[model samples]
Each structure stands twice: as C-alpha cells, then as structure tokens.
Target: MSSSFERYQKRRLISSYFSVVLSVFLVLFLLGLLGLFVINSKKLSDDFKEQIPMSVYFKDQANDSILKAFGEQLQKSAFVKTDTFVSKETAASKHKDIIGEDFMQFLGFNPLQNSYDIHLKADYVEGDSIKKIERKFKENRMISDIVYDKHLVDLVNNNIKKITFYILIITGFLALIAVLLINSSMRLSIYSNRFIIKTMQMVGATKSFIRKPFIMRSIKLGVIGAVLAIVAIIGVLVYIDSQLPNLGVLDDKLMIGSVLLGVLALGVLISWFSTFFATQKFLNLRTDDLY
Candidate 1:
C-alpha cells in the first residue's frame, strides 16, 4: 500500500511538469511564427520595388553625346540600383522579341527613341519620391518623357501598411493570451503542492525559504520548454524554406538569432513570475483552505 501511494504521487508530479512544458511550447511556437512573418515582409517589399522601373525616353533626333552623358548621370544617382541604356537598335530587338515581328521594317523608319531603364532603391520606390525623380529628369532637354507605374506603387505601399498594422494587433492579442495560459497552468501546478507549502509555514519557514525551491524549479522547466519549442520551430522553417525557395528571409541568421533569444527570455521570465505569484497565494491561504 505504501509503494502504491508513492507511485501515485510520482505520476502526479510528472503530470504537473508536462502541463507547464506544454503551455510554454505552444506559446513560444506561435511567437516564433510571428517573427518569421515580420522578417519575410521586408524582403517581399524590396522585390516588388524592383519590378517598377523608372524609364527616361530621349528626345527625337537627340544628340548621341547628350544621351550618353545622361546615362552616366543616372548611374551616379544615389537612388539608382541599376541602369541600362537602350539604343534604338536594342529597343527594336526587344520589341521584335515581344511581338515576334520587325515593326521597324514594316514602318520604313524606327519610331522608337533611345531610353534609359533606371531601377531605383527600395527607399525611393514611393510615389512622391518617384515624382520628384521624374521632375529632375524633365529639366534636361535631351529627355522626352519619364514613365513608370504610379498606380502600382501606391497599391503596394498602402497594402503593406495595412498588413503590418493588422499583424501587430494580432500579435499583441496573442501575447496576452499566452501570458494568461501560462499563468493558469502554473497556478494549477502550485495548487497541487498546497499541503507542502502549509507544512513548511507551520515549521516556521520564512516566505523566501519556501519560495526559493519553487522559483529555481520553474526556471529549469522554462529553459527546457524553450529549447523544445525552438527545435520544433527550426523543423517547420526548414520545410518552408524548401517549399518556397524565393523567401530569402529564412536565410537571415542575425534576425532569427534575436528572435530565438527573445523566446528564451520570455519563457523564463513568464515562468518565474507565475511561480512566484502562485507561491505567494498559497502562503497567504488559511490552513483550512489547504484541505
């Protein structure tokens, strides 16, 4: 009968420990997923910016020297990520490739003018910035027109702002849920040890002495749970990176390291506070309540 009681007590202790670990793992994994989304969004923004080119078309019968100089000037601009000078022949070749016919041959004269294809940096991809850049090119006599997809720029920027805002709200709400879940789990674990806590108090044990062992045990469990959560996150990231090769955000080591550190700190901090508060409640309870 004595051995059976001991086995039952051991099983109960294991069950309480599993409960704490499971709560922490679920919270940390969700947080890790949020971190990945934040990192990947930045990369996606840059990719979209590259797709809109700032095109500068040269005037009809413009001097070759002036066009060449303009191409050099474009390369010197801080906002220019890349620039390509499109001569009449090169433009004709591009059109032929697109339409599968030589329009210049049908028209007897190539109507296409020389142009410069300027790819701007991510920071200068907005409508206002692109407008300012266009005005700058208009001052040059050799340029005929500057063209780009203004609607596309506005659409991408506005949608990105909305997405970022919604993600922040969702993450904050989830964080509060995580805290409440972990705290409830910790309180239940402490409730099981109420008899031990009251017996310690009866023996003249100080509150600090009673709390020390529980705090230490909580920290250990928190670290273990964090490690397990990180392992699971890594597995999911690997599968995602394989399926989506274009998501270079997954390759960012520094950001991912910081995220992992945050997870570890959050897990440990929450566990420590939960254990401390739960122990305090048990200490303050009446002896009759322990029954």
Candidate 2:
C-alpha cells in the first residue's frame, strides 16, 4: 500500500509538470503568430504597392541625357522605391504584347512616348499623396503627363489601416487570455501540494523559506516551456520559408527575435507571480482546509 501511494504521487507530479509545459507552449505560439503579422505589416504593404506602377511621360524634346538625369534624381528621392526609364522602343514592345500587333510597323512610327515607370515607397502609396506627387512631377519642364490608378491607391491604404487596427485588438485580447490560462494552471498545480506547504509551515520553516523552492521550480518550468515554444516558432518560419517562398516577408529576424525575448520574459514573470500567490493562499489556510 505504501509503495502504491508513492507511485501515485510521483505520477501525479509528473502529470502536473507536463500540463504546465503544454499550457505555456500554446500561449507562446499564439503570441508568436500575432507578432509576425504586426512586425511584417510593411512588407505586406510593399507587396501590393510594387504591383501598381506610376508612369511619368516625357515631352517630344526629351533625350537620353534628360531621361538619365531624371532617373538619377528619382533614385535619391525619398518618395521613390524603384524607377525604370522606358524608351520608345521598349514602350512599343509593351504595346505589341497588349494589342497583339506591331502598331509601330503598321503606322510607320512609334506613337508611344518615352516615360519613367516608378514604384513609390509603401508609406507614400495613398490617394492624396499620389495626387500631390503627380502635381510635384508636373512642376518639372520635361514631364508631359503622369498616370496611375487613384482608386487602387485608396483601396490599398484603407485595407492596410484596417488590418493594423484589427491585429492590435486581437493581440491585446489574446495576451489577456494567455495570462488567465497560465494563472489557472499554476493555481491547480500548487493546490495539489497544499498539504506539503501546510506541513512545512507547521514545522520551523518560515513563509519566505518555504515559498522559495516552489517559485524557483515554477520559474524553471516556465523558462523551459518558453524556450520550447520559441523553437517551435522558429521551426514554423523555416517551414514557411521552404514551402512558400513567396511569403518571405514572414522572416524578419529583428521582429522574431523581439517576440522570442518577450515570450521568455512573460513566461518567467507569470510563473513567478502565480507561484507566489498560490503558495501564499495555502500558507494561510487552516489545517482542515488541506482536506
């Protein structure tokens, strides 16, 4: 009977430890996902912004030197992420691809004008800013006309703003949920050892002395669980990088590193507080309460 009782207690302790680890892993995973979205929001915006090109048309008098100078100027401009100067021949080829005929051959001259195709910085790709940019371009003497999709700019900006707002809200809510869950798990684990805590108090052990071991153990468990979860998060990034190379934006090292550090700090702090409180509760309880 003595042996059976000891075995049962050993199994129960092991089960409690596993339970705490699983809980911490799940919470950290959720937080990792939220961090990924928040950190890579810029990459998300740039992906769409690059697809919508802004064209700056040139005058009849514009030559290779003029176009080259303009390209060099744009390269230094904060508004420009990338720019390409398209000559008349290249424009004609693009037209051929679209119209399914060499219109230049039929008309005896290329009607398309030379132009600069520019992609704006992600932050500058908005409706009002794009219009202001067009006006800014028109101030130059060499530029004849500028064209871009006003509606698309509006759509992209609006969608990005909405996504940012929702992600923030969800992150806060989930973080709260994670804390509450870890607290409950810690409470339950401590509750199982309530009699031990009470018996130690009955002896010569002071409150602080008894509290030390439980808190230390909890801290260790928390750290182990957090480290495991961080490994899982890194594994997730590696898997995505290999399987969906198109989503490379998800691999921002600084952001992932920040999230990992945050998880470690949160896990240790939460475990410390939960263990302290749980031990405190049992310490003050009456002897009959142990039953």
Candidate 3:
C-alpha cells in the first residue's frame, strides 16, 4: 500500500509538470505570432510607400538641357527615391497604346507632355509632405504642372497607419492576457507540488534551496518552449515566402533574427517570473492551506 501511494504521487507530479509545459508552449506560440506581425507590419508599410508615385509634368517648350538639369536637381532632393525622365515621344506612344491607333490619327502632333515619374522616399508619402513637394515643383519655370493621385496617396498612408496602430494595440492586449493566463496556470501547477516543497522545508531546507529545483525546471521548460515556437514561426515564414516571393518583407535576415531572439527572450523571461512568483506564494502558504 505504501509503494502504491508513492507511485500515485509521482504520477501526479509528472502530470502537473506536463500540464505546465504544455501551457507554456501555447503561450509562447501566441507570443511568437505577435512578434512576426510587429516585424512584418513595418516591411509592408514600406512596400506600400514605395508604390506611391509623384509625377512632375514638363512644359511642351522645355528643352532637353532644362529637363536634364531639373532631373538632376530632383534626384538630389531629400524626398526623391528614384526619377525617370519620360520624353514626349515615349509618353505619346504609351498613351497611343492605351487609346489605340485609330485615336492617334485624330491628333495633328503628339499631344502627350514630357514628365518625370518620381518615386518619393517612404517618409514623404504623407499629405503634408507631398503638398510641400508639389509646391516646390510648381516654383520651377520648366514645370507645366505636377500630376499625382492625391486621393490615392492619402488613402494608402492613412490606411497603413491605422491598420498598424490597430494591430499593435490588439497584439499588446493579447500578449498581456497570455502572460496572465500562463502565470495563473503555472501557480496552480506549483500548488499541486506543495507537499514536496513542504517536505524540503521540514528537513531544514532554506527557502532558496526549496525554490531552486522548481526554478530550474521552469527555465528548462521555457527554453524548450521557445525553440518549438521559433521552429513553428520559421515554417510559417518559409511557406509564406514560397507563396509570395515578392513580399520582400521576410527577406531581411537581420529583422527576422531580431524577432526570433525577442520571442526567445520573452518566453524565458515570462516563465522565470511566473514560476518564481508562484513558488514564492506556495512557500508562504499555511500548511493547512496546501490542499
């Protein structure tokens, strides 16, 4: 009967340990996913910013020299990422392709204006910055008019900012909830092992001596859980990259490495803190309250 009781107690402790580890894994998985979102959100925003076009139309009478000088000046500007000078003939051919050969016959000469197709720096995509850029172009004598889709630029900037902020808030809240839930679950697990802790205490063990084993176990579980979460995250990223090679977001090795490190650190920190606090609570509990 004594042997059977000891076996049963060992089984219970094993079960509690497994339960705590499983809970930690689930929480770490969620935290890893959140970290991925935070990293990729910035990448996606930059991709969209690159797509916003700001075109500067040139006067019909403007000479090639003036256009060339203007192009060089624009290239040197802080806002411009890249600029291509589209000649009147090239613009006309593109326009003709759109409207067809029959539409071109009605024109006496090529009516399409020469222009510079400009891609601005990511930071200049906002409405105020773009307006300032447009004003600078208007000051140029060779510029006919600056043409850009204002509404589209505004919509893209606004949407990206709003979505990023929303995701950040939601992810933060979910992470907090995950930490709290994991902490509670770990506390319950440690509480079930209260007898073992009590036995150590009765043997004149110091508080630190009794807590050492549980803390070590927690750290081990945390490291294992972090590794598993990183593997899962990598699998997801690989699948995504295969499907969308143009994502460009996942191509950054440094960013991805940082995110993985962050997830690992978060897992270890949360587990250590949770277990430490839980064990401290159990140590303080009255003998009668151990149940």
Query: Which residue pairs collide, candidate 2?
Result: none
Model 3 per-residue lDDT tens digits across residues 1-291: 999999998998778777666776777777777777777777778767878777788887899898888988987798888888888888877877887774457766777788999998888888898898888888888788888889988888888879888988988887888789778767877877888888888789999988888888887777777788889888888888899888865778897888889878877888889989999888888888887
Candidate 3 segments whose C-alpha is farther than 4 A from its true place: 1-11
Consecutive 10-residue window with the lowest summed lDDT within model 1:
244-253
Clashes of 2: 0
Error of 3 at 107 (Å): 2.0
Candidate 1 TM-score over all chains jointly: 0.95
| Ranking of all candidate structures by their lDDT, best first | 1, 2, 3
- Local error of candidate 1 at 211, Å? 1.3
| Model 2 TM-score on a 0 to 1 scale | 0.92
Instruction: Residues 1-291, candidate 1: write the lDDT tens digits.
Output: 999999999999999999999999999889887987777787788878977888889988688889888878877899899999899889999999999999988699988989988899988998888889888989997788888989899998999899999999989998998889988988888898999999999999999999999988888888888888888888888888888877765678888889988889999999999999999999999998778
CA-lDDT, candidates in order: 0.88, 0.87, 0.82
- Deviating ranges (above 4 Å) for candidate 2: 249-251
